[model samples]
Target: MSAEAYSKAYIARCHKTLKEWGAPLDGWFVFNVYDCLEEANELFTCELCGCTQVRIVHVMHNHHYFERISVGCICAGIMEGDILAAKERERLVKNRAKRRKNFLKKTWEETRYGVSLLWYRGKRLRIFRLGNGRFKVCYNNTSTECHKGKPITDFLTAVHAAFDLIDPVVEIWHA
Candidate 1:
């Protein structure tokens, strides 16, 4: 079913059930949502609607119980005051980008080389300074090669070149 249908159904089903007691649906609050992944569906389910596509609601509270309710983005918006609104989403995105940029800047300034979470050719990578005033990048986290035993001349060249006898590997991101 469409997201709107899901939201409407969810609200219809939950509005009264939650209101019969002292607690009510309108009494609830949504603090934040799951940090989304690029290609993978977030792991969660909607607490109010029984929908399984929840983006992972951080909090669904009714003053008495602070519970974690996994609600889809649609449910989150319809019931919880547009937590997924375009403006909110844009702010979140920009905040994340700023934080990432800051992290990379700090890393670059403090140390020229270190283990990075960034992936390269589906492998975790490491950048370390050489004794010869050059930089080297290697797959340091796994039992691997493809320049595993070779010395890279510089950061950029190491990332782009198929050094030694290994095939050219792609860097996933600079940071």
Candidate 2:
């Protein structure tokens, strides 16, 4: 089948699976989408369990009259066995949000004058100043020759490849 068709079918299956489990769908968004018919696939992992066990309890497909519109549901594993209590869940969520905010701020700083994005022989590389006051390579955008309608995946792989070029002493965090 075509890639767009495959994406649609796969999303449908994910919805089905979540429905079968009666999972709560919250804080979900479309990670990315093609112009009309494809989306990058995402799997929700338990932040507490270190990934591997499924904690999804349901799926809610809110329909919108737009092409390529889809939702990615992230199931909070709070309902799982020996899961964190209400207070603990609140603390975890707060901490995660704080980290996410900090990450975004750092990325913005790097994207601004704090970092330099240069193109060398058709490859993009980033030179940034770390919080610790050190100049380093933050990313290298080489080997991103493959391009389909999957802009999300292509963009991510490029960013990651660039991150891989970062200096070992630099600590790069993501949200």
Q: In each prediction, how many residue pairs overlap at the backbone (N, C-alpha, C within less than 3 A)?
A: 0, 5
At residue 20, give the lDDT of candidate 2.
57
Which 10-residue window in model 1 sums to the lowest lDDT? 165-174
lDDT of each: 0.46, 0.34
Per-residue error at 99 for model 2, in Å? 1.6
Candidate 2 deviation (Cα RMSD):
16.3
User: What is the C-alpha lDDT profile of model 1 across 46-98, one tens digit per residue?
Assistant: 66667665443434555664454545555555555554462354355435534
Q: Clashing residue pairs, candidate 1? A: none
Candidate 2's C-alpha runs over 4 A off are 1-79, 85-94, 107-175
The superposed Cα distance between candidate 1 and the true structure at residue 83, in angstroms, equals 6.3
